[model samples]
Target: MSDLHELRIERHIAAPVDVVWRAWVDHQAEWFCPRPWRASVEVSELRPGGRSVVVMHGPAGEEMRHEGVYLEVVTGERIVSTDAFTAGWRPAGPFLVRIDEFAADGAGTRYAAVARHWTAEARDQHAAMGFEAGWGAAADQLEEVVRRLVAGG
Candidate 1:
């Protein structure tokens, strides 16, 4: 009955929210994405109403930016934003709204990210485009960082 459908992936990191947040929003972006062909996440603004950009730098020195505006931001808790295919939120193509939530637990920190699609077709398209695999790979990288930092590495 809902117009939107969501897909999510979560990981429990062995670090506090701040540490995990930094890793997630900062360092990991440089090495995130499922494949080497994709660009690394470039810029991020961690405040409400701020803007973020992810630039995919090509081997041939070409650049592509994925820009978005933050819809909501709660320090150490959540971030909701919409991303466009091009730079500066100009939207070279369709856009996706994402919700990222974080919580502190005995396991350390619980981090979850959800992508909402306007239709089933969009969702299916994303799946075909490697949504799970890409996000999953990124999460795996984050997990390694969180564990290392928490363990005093």
Candidate 2:
């Protein structure tokens, strides 16, 4: 294992853990990216060792496809995914591992996302790419989707 770098962001969503998790798993396309960028899930398996693929389409029609595997999954609690290995644990160019966690917070849910990189340089590059603002905006979009789902919209 080499030295790792991390970037984390936390938010309070006005919905229950189950609701938030549902939005995360079911409505990902609606909030996976910030405004002017859209995401579509080509494949999503909510289980350990399963494959997950998401394509983000930019405003100018550029597409970024993320292919990864789920390392761990705890229904309604946590999800860990990594690009270090693809489905079936095949080795790939290491990038980052992401952990998405949801916990009960009073009448709402406390949501957090942690992205661990293989090097400090990668972490700094992500920061320079506006990771905080981009991820924060995505979080806000996620909350909106969750709220709508919880409200039966």
lDDT of 1 by residue, 46-128 (tens): 77667777777666777777787777888889988887433344554554789888999885888898889877888888888
Candidate 2 local lDDT, residue 57: 99
lDDT of 2 by residue, 1-153 (tens): 236699989998988899999999999999999989999999999899999999999999999989899999999999999989877888988778999999999989999998899899988888899999999999999999998998898
RMSD to the true structure for each prediction, in A, is 3.1, 2.0
> What lDDT would each prediction earn against the true structure?
0.75, 0.92
Report the C-alpha displacement of residue 79, candidate 1, in angstroms.
1.0
Candidate 1 residue spans exceeding 4 A from truth: 1-3, 35-42, 58-63, 84-93
- Structural similarity to truth (TM-score) of each candidate: 0.80, 0.95
lDDT of 2: 0.92
